[model samples]
Target: MLAIECAGLTKHFGDLTAVDHVSFEVEKGERFGLLGPNGAGKTTTIRMLTTVIPPDEGTAKVLGFDVRRKPDKVREKIGVVLQGLALEFFSTVYDTLDIYGRIYKMNAENRKKRIEYLLSEFELEDKRNERIDCLSGGLQRRVQVATAFMQPPEILFLDEPTIGLDPQSRRKIWQFIEEFSKGGYTVILSTHYMDEADYLCSRIGIIDYGKISALDTPEGLKSTLGGGDIITFGVEGNVDLLRSTISKLDYVEEIMAGDELAARVENADEVLFKLSEEVVKAGAKIKNISVRKPSLEDTFIKLTGRRIE
Candidate 1:
């Protein structure tokens, strides 16, 4: 069954259109991602699908229930971990989770077993007695996510779940998501981190300016950029001249400008040698140079004409 079906979904904030005519489908057991930088409408799309806010136009259905007409039914089958940390600050880790289980109408015995299991799984067993305020930001996030699973809803909506987290914390969250997805659950995650989307999502919809610019699997999206390696030159000066100069190179297929000007080029030693020589003549000094395979970031850059930060 399709986990989500959205067509021409739009949301407007007065003068500005937050989500403009967006459409996509997510299948059961799939890890789907809405990828873009902040203010790109990733969060807005999640809000509409989760029935947190009604869409200004178009339609959205979650697990076959229309979000606008059957919001309660939709909520019954989904779990939401929003951008904000929605945990009780004064409660201990154990009480926080146990209370949520109670809210979900779980039996006493079931709550105990489930809480124990979650504590162990989330590595919170040692921190069970500690107050949530005493835990680190990462642990608090982990606790917040655990609460969403109290009901063990069919679908989970994660909006930049690891935004403020450290690298280690982020990896742990990714691992948890990977583990949960193994049980055939559907997860729709929104993120601006290229590696996060590329690693966790089965297919990604690249959102820019509140619209999906492109939607494809990570490898599929990279393949669309064709056979090329991204050669980035850290230009010290005259970047504009360097961009214009590199665009004319016979071996350079496409170029993108940013802090470090990057080019998608045919991977050959001759191409690299000449590209460096041309950069110098263009009055730019190459502070650093690196060559790597084309990635989802490259695909995004090509689509939106800039890099995501």
Candidate 2:
């Protein structure tokens, strides 16, 4: 079954359009990612699908329930971990999960067992009795994540879920998410971390300026950039002049300049050699140079004309 479906889903914030005629489908148990720079409508799209907000036009269904007409039913089957930390300052880690489980109508015994399991699963056992406000930001995030899993919702919406987490904590969360996916949980992951998306998502949609710019699996998206190495040059003189020369090369697929002059070419060796000669002809001295295979970041840059940063 399709876990989520959207068709021309649009949202406007007065004078600005936050999500513009977006459409996509997510399959059951799939790890889907919404990738974009800030203000690119990634969060807005999640809100619409989660039934947190209504779309101005078009339609969305979460697990076959219309978001606008059956919001309560939709909410019942989904869990959300929003962008920032959301926790009660005075509640202990144990208390927080216990309270959430209670709200989900879990019985006392089940809540107790579930809470204990979650604390251990998320490596929060040591912080069980500690008040949330007294924990570090990472621990607070762990509590928030654990709370989301309390009811075992069919779908989980993770918005920048690992934003401030330490590397160890982040990996642990990734492992949990992977395991959850294997158990038939659908995850909609909205994150700025390209590597995280590449690591966890089965497919990704790149959004820019409120529009879906590209959609594919991580490798699929990277392949669309033509399977070339990205060559970056830090030059001492005449970057524009150097860019003009590099852009003329037949093997060069694309070029962009910011702090450095970068080009995508089919053969890095041939292009780099030609580029070196061109730079010298332009009276530019190469400060540094590097060539690497295409990555999700390169795909995003190709689509948006800039880095995600």
Q: In candidate 1, list every pair of residues with a backbone clash.
A: none
> Which 10-residue window in model 2 sums to the lowest lDDT?
251-260
Which ranges in model 1 have alpha carbons more than 4 Å from their true place?
A: 268-270
TM per model?
A: 0.95, 0.95
Candidate 2 residue-wise lDDT, 68-184, digit = tens: 999999999999999988899999999999999988999999999999999999999999999999999998998898889999889999999999899999998999899888999
Model 2 root-mean-square deviation? 1.6
lDDT for model 1: 0.90
Q: Write the per-residue lDDT of candidate 1 for residues 33-150, one digit (tens) a residue.
A: 9999889999999999999999999999999999999999998899999998988899999999999889788999999999998898888999999999999988999999888877
Cα deviation in Å at residue 201, candidate 2?
1.0
Error of 2 at 111 (Å): 1.8
Candidate 1, residue 213: Cα displacement in angstroms equals 1.1
